[model samples]
Target: MQNRLITCTLLLAALGGLSACNKNKGGKSDVTGWNYNDGKKSSGFYVAKPKDIKTGPGLVFVQGGTFTMGATQEDVMGDWNNVPRRVTINSFFIDKTEVANVHYREYLYWLENVFQDPQYEAVVKGAKPDTLVWRSELSYNEPLVEYYFRHPSYNYYPVVGVTWKQAYDFCIWRTDRVNEKELIDKGYQNQNVLKQELNGGGQDNFNTKSYLMGEYQGVPGKPKKNPLKDAQGRPRNTVKFEDGILLPDYRLPTEAEWEYAALGLINENPSPRRSEKQRGEELISNRQMYSWKNDGYDNLRATRKGNWQGAFLANFKRGNGDYMGTPGGLNDRSAYPADVNSFFPNGFGLYNMSGNVNEWVADVYRPTTNQDEDDLSPYRGNEFKTVDVSGGEGNLRDSLGRIKYVNENDSSLRNRFNYQRSYAVNFLDGDSLSSSSYGYGITTLISDKSRVIKGGSWNDMPYWLSPGTRRFLQEDQSSSTVGFRCAMTHYGAPEGAGSKHKTGNFFPTRRQKR
Candidate 1:
């Protein structure tokens, strides 16, 4: 009409100068997935996108050193109550085993098929686990109290009497069934919630960032005939520690990170000339109250298949009419099943640490807890589901009568250390040996019946299997000789390998003298 309106007003003024240079290059392209950049930043770096690390939760680590934790001068039972001391531990991760009984009967069969709905069935029958108090008269444990926790061949042993708050509520139902199988492998659950609930339980929703952004959905939460594709198609989960993905919180090892990881002495490795002498042992040093040195297996040294028969690494009941082998040879399946990898793992791989059962440690019994504990990683105790009314979230108690402490930095306390009052204390620093006492501060007139307990049971006696023998009960006790194992801390390590001090060596070599 006027040359077609001047070529439609010059194509509407070149589409209004391409929409004002995309509104000065930032108003974001009118929506459809918008973009004037900041899609969580892709170039100046901020691309963490996270969540892909998923697997099945594996990690085991442990490391750290500076031993002499409690009694390893061979402990002839002067019952000095785990004296020795020294201390230092850090680096963490655990759970190589020891939470068995068919993985807590799949958390009591998913809390009895999702609390059979009777109004959340008393929190699923109070998440069961009093397996009829592992029954016994003098013996004849009634076929392990009627088929060892519903037999599956005792599904890899270890799960005895429970309690340490039922293995911390089975590590919170194994971190909510591994983040609900990473939210139904990313489709945000539509099925496969452990094979369609296997009878009950299902509606958990699940959507972990649309499977960390790939957009998962092989039918899981449904949708994606082609919705951007990728959708968590690969990573099944469990390699753990490529440097992320751990959040589940089972916690509980702090009696000096369980006697500095039951003194495994950070499992060696050196050789690379940091003053390389090779044999005199310096790089990773010694320590070792029981994680390995009585040898038998886990090879910290003895290369080319040479050492390790020194045996007696753990599984007590020996030397006084002995139990596991001699006395009519092979009694009660060699005295209530040993070999859950027999023994020797410490320097962080973990394993029995000293003997077997006898664990529970979150510390609370304050026998003046080594002057005032906490060089770092130190611990006292608390249980009532580990308190945490929020305020700082980490939580610690004390002040009902007072004793708390805290130093090394004091960001309002998560851990600095100090604890020791479950009866039996001379300690102003005195015990462990006697140097005219100087424990510096010491306090604990008795706080509700002490607590701490560490590696060494299976009917104990190898000098209480030394991992710094200090014992206690009442916190709603439970024992088959006590059992517990779970820890986790190492979250990245950069600030000078997360607080330095790796070199080792200690135990009976001499120190407790004061």
Candidate 2:
């Protein structure tokens, strides 16, 4: 026994030396130390340093918390759809304000310039807002129809007349633009790459997935020293995603995330000790009717002292025919949708969460989603797919220069134990014999095309201004009273360290030996 103990001690000492030697002269881990090389030849392997996550432009981090999702006030509509339920939301970054007319115009400008071909012209045109949506049969809205989006005066207003599909496409475009700019700023690529003219429109666009998969390459720039060496000790020519340089893809906020953010209940619920020890004891004080300080709907005045004292809290219809307020003393100040940042922000520092244009969320419409969804970070829509390997070179690019993906099939996923199905889009709402009994189209108006729209619009009454009040619209249909904001998943913690929440550690804790 004494001999065995001494042997173990010696082995541990050797491991300590091994760890110290694995670090390079610069104090970074050398990839070679990980024993990653195959027998074939010398290759590059990167040990990426963790990067500081910079908040994307126009975004506010919504430090997530537990809250009762659904109607906070009386269900005046009698829908019973939004039955209150407890749910926990994960922290995520969201646009501080709605996407404005100027933002949409920038997207359009890129579309027009990149996709100038006759075949792609239709694609560009489809992205344009339906200006005619502003027109009404009785009202003379001709001026609004022509000028709402194009006029400089309305440039800062939340963009409307955009379909859910169009908003989703805009998110994708924004992600690529932001990431491409990041690479350029880091000197990984040339600054003039964005300026280079391509013959096939979107075919040469910088899609994040495509670029990472080695399927797309921009204009050549000053190449960095590749860690992987060839037979002759020459550097390689590729950049891998493991370098931790790219940002995550932006998407529409899920239904639970949106509702949780809009409520911004964190300010009302104070946790003296935010550790796991006190998690269950954190108490939510007053239930909110609007995204504001008071439970009363009529209390629109700013509680804090400043120039904002007695100012309206949000932009919405006060009563029947009372859009703004009487004459000179306009209550909410605007008859139409106001500037995206006009009103006071919620507890999460997000503007117009309760009133403005109703925003589209990334949820398939289902009245029963609350009952069936997971308590933690609840969401409804998910469609599983795998990278297509049929072309032999698995990462083969299609004509559009995007990596191709196919729905997972039973034969290909034979050994997988967790998932046996190809698609999960309608996983919980399709057939009775399946996991979920809620039927789509056949028994209800809910279909794959139906998407959830949350918050209230400028045309909406006070009842509709509640954050929990949800409605549905077809994905392809545009609406003058609806708009959207983008969201990005938070990579690390639920409550970001040094943030207002001051709760749990920002990263995973190392497991203790038993």
Question: Which candidate should be chosen as best, given TM-score against the real structure?
Answer: 2
Q: Candidate 1's residue-wise lDDT over 1-514, tens digit each?
A: 2233244335422431333334434444444434432424321111111122222365466645455666656656564555665656755666664566677777777767644556666655655656666677676677777776677776766766666666666665665567556444544455555554445543332222222222223234553431221223322332111113334345666777776666655445433222213332445455455566433343322333444433444676765656565554432234664545555455556677676677787776655567656565666543211222233312222211111232222233345255333222333334454454433226433444346777767777666666777777655557666766666555333111211221242134555655
Q: What does the lDDT come to for candidate 2?
A: 0.76
Lowest-sum lDDT 10-residue window in model 1:
42-51
TM-scores for candidates 1 onward, in order: 0.30, 0.83
Cα displacement (angstroms), candidate 1, residue 332, comes to 26
Which pairs, if any, clash in model 2? 44-228
Where's the lowest-lDDT run of ten residues in candidate 2?
35-44
Cα lDDT for residue 223, model 2?
Answer: 52
Give the TM-score (vs. native) of candidate 2: 0.83
Give one digit per residue, the lDDT tens place, for model 2 in 151-268. Answer: 9999999999999999998998899899888777766678777876344456787887777666677864555654543434455344444445677779999999999888877667
Which sections of candidate 1 miss by over 4 Å?
A: 1-46, 49-66, 77-89, 93-103, 107-140, 147-158, 161-176, 181-192, 195-258, 261-356, 359-454, 469-484, 493-514
